[model samples]
Target: MNRKTLVLPAVVGLLAPVLAACGGSDSGSGGDDGAIVVGTTDRFTATKDAPAPFDPAYSYDVGTWNVLRQTVQTLMIQPKGDGDPVPEAAQSCGFTDSGNERYACKLRDGLKFSNGDPVTAEDVKFSIDRARSIKADSGVFALLSTIDTVETQGDNEVIFHLKTADATFPFKLSTPVAGIVNPADYDKGKLREGFAIDGSGPYTLKTETDGDAVTKAVFTKNPEYKGVLDVKNEKVDMVSFEDADAMGAALDKGDIDVMTRTMTPEQIKKLSDAAGGNKESLVELAGLEIRYLAFNTSAPTVKTKAVRQAMAQVINRSELVSAVYGTQAEPLYSLVPASVTGHSNSFFNTYGDPDPAKAKALLKEADVSTPVKLTLNYTTDHYGAATKQEFEQLQKQLNASGLFDVTIKGTPWETFVPAERKGQYEVYGMGWFPDFPDADNFLAPFLDKDNFLKSPYKNGDIIDDLIPQSRRVADRLTAAKSLTKIQDIVAQDVPVIPLWQGKQYVASSDDITGTAYVLNSSASLQLWELSRGVSG
Candidate 1:
């Protein structure tokens, strides 16, 4: 989880009935056969500043590139509810017998891209190789670090030769970062030049207005998109809003069918009330995305393990959750949220309640006579309604402890990412929406040295012993034991403090049907599974 908190000041008055204004009815939805309208907060704007190319190989924010990847294909996909690999573009994949080092994948017959190009083993090889070589923003490439070389065994089969023996190699392939693209799209050994849409997934980009910059992606049924996506809606019209309020208003006014991200608790409550009586008019799906705070351990003051532990004990997570989110969020004690495999309450076990006495004791043990002053930073609009309040509560709790002085800073995501990456603040708040549904996704990103946070922690036990030992074991139950140990160490060390795990609130119009509310590890909505209900 990234250490950023978003606290939305409650809108004081009750919302009046928003006037419904009918805009241009797109050819898809009800008027046209097999089309659905979806609403989302914030459109990606490159008008003022050109966006980096949308290549899965380097794209770090998985949420932004979700639609594009739906049009593309990956080697494997996580079977719903388990970390086990299920074939998507690949027909079958498994590890070699030599201590889980070598891995091989076989593609299904007659698979082709939207452009009608055959999906050969070379294309799969090119996709994975480019992801590693390009080194784009994606954390997914971190998984490819274990791979030493790629060898193509004919058009249908490919083999991955590994530098490390890891049984979790197949799970990495299940991420969108491993989504397959056309080999011909890129120039010879170049990263930034390729930006064409040529994927073999369930959808194809039908109409995109680059100048106006509103992306209206249309997904037609790919006869070859015979994977696990039980698509109920044939076409999806994704319209973007400037912020969550706009998206919420659109849903209330019946202009859009679905709303995602940036949804506030107030909006969720209203929608929930609306859905209660009218079953056909609305639907809700609660999901698991964890939010937390990260301490830059490399910083001078935070360098002491005692100080880190003290901070964790001082901040009251229960109070933060109640004040910021009300009943919207559940207090999280582990890095792995409750929905994912291998979740354990190690932090809760260690620190039962916020005790100022315990914090002062730890601070004194570190030999800190003067009051420790630290700056806590969080992104303004990223996490949701509860972020700002959560930080404020944290600040109050820490200040009340009398052992520490705290300063809080807030910035927008555009400025926050670079700032946090450069270690601008002593401590910052952030959340992790998983890239895939696995305990490893939670553990790997924050703990891994090269990740976005770039934590300077050098625990040989976690890096060398625990993480590697866990990856070697294929059985999830056995691997979970090692992960539990890692969390226990994290609770003690406090490099990153565990806050609250998120419960997703999605409200859909009564007119929608067949919406399987499966929260993918990324916390992104799977729009293809939704359809128009019998009545709008």
Candidate 2:
């Protein structure tokens, strides 16, 4: 738990080639004192029922973690490219037992948070124990569930005892869930309520808020920090936009140095067309983010495998990607995206291009009548404005086939999340941004018995055998065979239908340096990597 340098995986290598050219510059304005300005539509909002989004115990989304990665130091940090986590707060960390259950890390000699409090083993223990004990619904309790107990060894070292062998435990420590906070600034049982942040990261953050919404977060380089990251910029101003159009416009008008997160397909196309003027302005990186549909297996409508498989056969991914997303995304054929270590196009292999004939044949074979009824649900506000168009396109495709009756419904994200979680929807939409960069992260969350999807998707081979087997291997690539088998099983069962894979695009004013480094394969932005300068 104590901040220490731990090893990470080689997931970065998967995207490094595409990101190699992101560091160059062309022409654009720079912030004062070499500071950087960033625009994003990703809002970190806190609700009355949920804890403060800034608190590590409560913050579960990618947007909040993007900011937290800059201000709050984890025990280990994932470096920019192809390697394990280097020592930031901790000097060294690794599994101490052959079973991979006992992990330990020794803190650096003189590590301190922004508050000047010494980073110690006890603080690490308190942080982990408090997070596990709170178990807030909004918190990442699932990620920390593997830890059986935390014990401190002297003032500089901390040890973790796990319930089972988990080779992915080290990667978990590199996430914001394992972010080490100052014990004094946080309570043992409650979430941190205010905007004030104290941590051992490379920068210190101050926020500008309107009511509960954060408008901007100003990050100043922490002079009293010690970490593996090289602080490239003296200051960073992260500005939040209500929508992607405004954010895109800000980048065009030079109001912001960089634009990221959610941009409309139209805006992306515009930028992509304009990229010929200055190619470096549009920085594209290999992304692991994906969008898919989750079917409630227990629901009366989509419960049968024949119905789900037929729908899968009828849903044309190529058309969906072209009409809805344009060139913004690619058709994803598997639960595990192509960027991950072990990815197979099991769905594509089973059912080729959209075949209404095959779909009708499937239904006939199963003794089901034509024009089967199905309600496709999607969120109107959460993912992006394009979501509405995406589902409408799906409805068109399904209805055009004349093989089924499909009704497309749209709901606000606030209501959609709870409704889907409670299994109120027969078939609903979901998007995944990985908690870590690995094949296990892509599979375990949905295939497990107690999955986040809340769908009745339980496979004994996947949940009990394949998943556990995959996690036991330290080398992630070696576990690809097992991961492929798990994907094959899910494809056959048709619990979830893979839709499209997303690519990370950050449009920066040509003057911005390190735009490529701003986001990793996991799609988490490291603000410290952004600096004001002309690219080569």
Candidate 3:
């Protein structure tokens, strides 16, 4: 998802240097997971699990964005592990006004959709303008809040007028939300007829096979494409599974060349334990994703800061990581990932260790009765299957403190998301998948009134003061000091408790080289970098 700064090496095979970086051979060659047939249940190329809308403007989740990256061309793009927004579809682009509110770009000549429609400035204008207008569930509008108008001048030039002066505007253009779409093929307020896309990307849909509500889409080199990525293979086959089991079975049978995300902790353990299996078929990418418990401040028991702080104080992250997640994830002490700028151990800094006796004293100080009764809510579908055991472990830990009697409840993600948004659960599990690699994304989304968290957290210093101040600075490194303070404040306030950061893994059959090198930081596979190993 050159769409955001992320990694699993969760696209591990994509970062070939990681092995050398991790003390492997210099060429960073994966032995041979490089089979021609690739299989993944990862949502990065989907219309269902993630932001399922296949149209460029409607796709927001990383899975959908990754698929679009192969199918559509944007003005700019972010490469693996790098957040810088660089030229793609545009010959060149730059801000034209002193306010940093006006941007302009020149289209690369001879670009066309797979359908053969000429790509032009009007298509770029329409694509962006429609994304702002449609406002789909994928949450594309959050990234483009500064845009006010898009002006097209002839066939090659396009200019954007923005409502605010944002230096990150160029990075926004690199996303698929701004991928140019042909006006003749798409209508306003409606998605394209089917998920099969028509674009000027390196690959075009060649054939699609559907059965039992799951579809496998095959992409062949787009004859009309004139872009950067060199295609290593003539075709790529991607399939979406009913669930993890279906995908795991395919991998065991060598039905696919590679498998992406959604491997269960148990499944990951099995693969890693196999002899020479990890070295040949897998690469583990330590990730930036955080899994935590959000304490609904409106809930009667946790309404006060003292109660929330007690909950945070009593829980041990190390225990959760080991007992439940195994090697798949590590203990997290900060809201921001260490890979990103402004990552501080604010939570760790605030609370030194899991102090149950101290927790009971704090609850007493807050006038909370002994044996506090509380319910912990979670979703079985969104989080991995290991989540149930994790939450159960959490219940044991909280109960062992002698200050809490914790109850666990489970719901599916589709129902859980809306319910959590409505503040239906007193405390619920939430995972942070950054919209972009910026520390701003990790903080800003939690601060806004209409935030992704959907909570009633209104910290004026964070939401109104620090975040705005942080965004005004163009350089992320310079903004770190300000953003780090934001995390410190959130940690002290305790609207949510930071638990653990995930370690992402990409399992590929050993025949593949470059699987680790091909994924962008977002763990979205650059499927083109993969090639089958030549047999002796």
- Give per-model TM-scores: 0.87, 0.91, 0.85
Ranking by lDDT: 2, 3, 1
Task: Give the alpha-carbon lDDT of every model.
Answer: 0.69, 0.79, 0.72
Question: Which has the greatest TM-score?
Answer: 2
Candidate 1: segments with Cα more than 4 A from true spot: 1-34, 42-50, 80-83, 193-196, 206-226, 274-286
True-structure lDDT of candidate 3: 0.72
Candidates 1 and 2, the one with greater TM-score: 2
Q: Write model 1 residue lDDT over 286-367, tens digit each, in one string.
A: 3557788898888997889888888888778888878777777878988988656688998878977888898888878889
Residue 91 error, candidate 3, Å: 2.0
Off by over 4 Å in 3: 1-35, 42-52, 81-83, 97-99, 190-196, 206-213, 276-280, 299-301
- Which pairs of residues have clashing backbones in candidate 2? 3-90, 4-90, 5-87, 5-90, 8-84, 8-85, 25-535
Question: Cα lDDT for residue 199, model 1?
Answer: 80
Better TM-score candidate (2, 3): 2
